[model samples]
Target chain A: MNTHLVEPEIVMAYRDGQLAAGEAAGVRAHLETCAECQEIAASLDDVSAQMRAWTVEEPSPQLAWRVAGRAGKPKGKFWWWHWPTAALVTAVLVVAVLPWKRPPAPTVQTGWLPVGSVRTSESNLPLPPAEPRRHDSVAEIGPQAQARTGQLGGVIGGIVSATPMAAPPTSVQRRTQAQFAMEARRGAAIPVPTAPMIARDATLNLTVKDFASVRDVVERIVRVHRGFAQNLALTYQAGRNNLTATLRIPDPELDRTLADLRYLGKVDQEAQNGEDLQAQHVDLAARIANSRVAEARLKELLANRTGKLSDVVEAENELSRVREDIERMQAQISSMENRVEFATVNLRISDTPPVPAPSSVWRGLSEAGRNGLTILGEGLMGVATWLLEYLPTLIVIVLVFFFPVRWLWRKLQARPAFRLPN
Target chain B: MDLTGSDESLMLEVKQGSEPAFIALFERYARPIHGYFRRRMGDPQRAEDLAQETFLALLKGARRYERRALFRTYLYAIAMNLLSAERRRAAKDRGSTTDEPATSADPDAVLWVRRAVEQLDDQQREVLLLREYEQLSYEEIAGLLNVPVNTVRSRLFRARMAMKELLVTR
Candidate 1:
């Protein structure tokens, strides 16, 4: 074996000046006798010299002119550096810095999930009542009515004997009733003999890949569970989709619904809250009794003709007020009961898909076209929206302030480029 | 010892709108940069064009330059990129043809050296040039090219060995 070929790398080390002093001396001794290694060193030197020969032409004189011209332009001259350029500078600074300053977007985890109810329908057993009011219904009524009315409920039944107003006319009554019902529905002060409920509240944020499919499944689930979607919003984009929904599921099915929702994707967030309204139910029951007693007293005053006209008028007014109060209270009780019967579930579904880079020219063109249109539309819409929102202010400024500013600017521009310092 | 500071001070003076400082930097680096391109390109006109571009680039990029690394390294890095880009464009224009046979007057020693140098691979060629012509230390070359010192050593060694073999064969 050729000794030099045995370790060509050693020759390299020698060339690199990495050889120890002793090693270098030995290499040098070998080199004095060996023509091959010497030739290698010479070749290395020639190669280095050849590599240094790669140079380029001077850029055009026009290039210097272009850069200098751009730098010297009135518009470009320390544009953001002048006090007068504050607004422009702010814009430039934001444009320059914002991209780098922006924090990376939070990564979204998403998957395909069923649109339907996650839980099976369960009985909406009525919730226990909330705390009772301090005053019992019968206790608030006058003693005289208490003796004659056979309970306030019966006494109220007999008063206002003048055709009993026939529950008012449907059109007039419907609106008032609707209003009353709305109040009752919202207030939960009146009791409708609704089924006993197990009230529950659940919040779930999950990821889903197919928003449309999930939405469909959710709707089906709501139907199967005998629940309703109170409010829902779905947003779709090319690479992402999301759905936020408020569902009123039967209280008994809430737990099951939550469990099923978990199957959709990794539950990023979840929460639940519940309260029993049983005591409130009992308190409302007592208030209805007392209102009935007040009605009885007023009816007696109207029917007996034992008091003066003024007294009778006062009594009738009092009776009307009592009955109205009773109706309002009942509406509130009903609303409360309904809420207790239904469990509210706020579900947030996120569909995050990996953004596949456009590979082909056609895809790129299409994407570019879409992006162009979007940017164009967004720009137009942004301008339109800004104009719409601030048009009045802008108009006022143009009339009251901007016209003068413009006139001043024109006057300033008319001045010599080299102006005397103020 | 303070090569970076010297280069930076020169550049700083230039950025302060000093024409002379810029001219000085140009004069100092001109031949080196010219030789750099001249060795690679067969056509003198093209090499001259690239050299001018290097100086102009240095001028325009003066204010933007950061002194995090050696100024020479930075300048050469820019020059290298420009050269590579030009070569790519030329290659593309010529329908991706590489290795057109050199037809130069010095069919003697210079031609022989060019052939032997060209025989080495790209990394080998770069390592040879950086060490022998630029006189960069192994560490400096490694840092400039963003490679390990050992890699630079090995490449340089391979280049020398290859050139040796090629020259001897001739």
Candidate 2:
């Protein structure tokens, strides 16, 4: 027997029954005589037989219960199982019948302008001119801001100042606006270098019976606590009024201020914020000192300027720069001092009772009935509106369907009755 | 015995909602089906669960059954789906840095056979299992798996060749 005639793969193919009838016969003929192929076949059979013997360990008996229970639960049909065709049709209808037109412009009593008109710079109206006023240190900026800024700044500052400020005592926010105003007026008064006032601030919402009563209580607390209002705003509406005052209280008096505030109403939300500005204040003081020295040196240089024209120009320019730096440093010192002197307490006092809304649902219904009747009586108005909206499309559709309808009518009229089959 | 008639009539009765016929079908196929799962999973518990799941699947899928293939083939196909799902779920739940290699507690010969079968890519393994274990004809396996008969032959050939090489090495 030629060993070349019986390959291992051919033996396996025969074992697996994958070979063609003729090839299988050839392998079988060789297998009857060839010891090598026979051995390979026997090994293959042994491997497969062993594989057949490798059985999985029986699962825990409890699995049967779990599986049976799971299988017993009624199988749910998928959502897409019901009325699939109808759902498909509905989707198509929604895509077709639903209006995809862009929204019409809102009726503008101002003017019926094109949608993108506001986008053009050409149509942009100039803002109203600002009114001029006197330049008094405080009174000047006041009259100009009296209505808007006064309502916001003074009252807002009062509320903020009432809240404890986190900055050290030396910060300018520690100073009440009144004190800052006074200091600015005293222009040359040497600022007393005091330890920075550090005030911790807390935000709390309180419901109060009366805004005025709360305001008074807050003020009394501030005075007793050695704090002052930085900004105060009192808005009086028809039913309820709101008084938001930012105040500054001494850190020692913060607890008492908070206690007084708690008595005013139910505290809704309260959060305290603390800031440490000791390092920042020190840094600012150093910068101011450096700027002052620089300013002094520049001033001396300006006084003794006797050089070439270009040199003198350069020296004056240097002085101008130094003056700017000094002014900036002074501003920074004032701000830091304010923060240190004043601890900001922002108090928001809103009326406990909600105001009754005007023309609620019932009123709106009555109004709608009247308006709707008015609109219905003017039936021609709706017709006009619809006509204006679709006239172009209607004309195009008419032209498109006219010839088709005419041809169909002619064909139908020309058709003869069917003769009976003979 | 008329095997096709008995199986078909039994399936038809089961389809008619006969709980008895279902019980009979279960009794007839439970061990073979369990053995099939056991061979594939190498875990007795998982095999038993899978066997039960295959029966449940057959029961549930009865309403949609058109007798398109031999009920056994259809049943094994459902078992295959359940097995694939279980394997996927197991892999997902493992969540290990390295994947566990597929091996059985069997002797080297059996492990060699399984590894060799696994080494033949997915299509080939499927064809081999259907041919060898399920004893499905090439044409029947092709129709059930939605592949051409010729493709089934080639895959089976490749599977056999790979298995022979594995067995030779062993």
Candidate 2 per-residue C-alpha lDDT over A79-171 given as tens digits, one digit per residue, 9 for 90 to 100: 222233334455556545757574343322232222111111112321122223222221222234334433333232322223332322233
The C-alpha stretches of model 1 lying farther than 4 A from their native spots are A1-422, B1-5, B12-18, B95-103
TM-scores of the candidates are: 0.36, 0.34
Number of backbone collisions per candidate: 60, 67
Q: Interface RMSD for each candidate model? A: 9.8, 16.6
Model 2 misses residue B46 by how many Å?
A: 4.2
Determine which window of 10 residues in candidate 2 chain A has minimal summed lDDT: A113-122
Give the Å error, residue A184, model 1.
58
- Evaluated at residue B86, the lDDT of candidate 2 is 80
Taking the tens digit of each residue's C-alpha lDDT, what string does model 1 give over B1-170?
22233766777666655654554565567667766776677666566677767766776676677778887888888788888898888877865332332545554666777777777788888877777766677777888789998898888887776776786677
Cα lDDT tens digits, model 1, A1-422, are 66674255566677768677998888877878888878766666664555345333443334333333323212222343223345444444544454432223223324433332221122112212222223222122244323323332322221111112112111111123466556543543344334433356889998765455676556544543446788889887666788899997656556655664665566789999876666666677678778777777778778998979999888888988987888877776656655665678999888767778889999999999999999999899989966675566445534554455556545544433221111
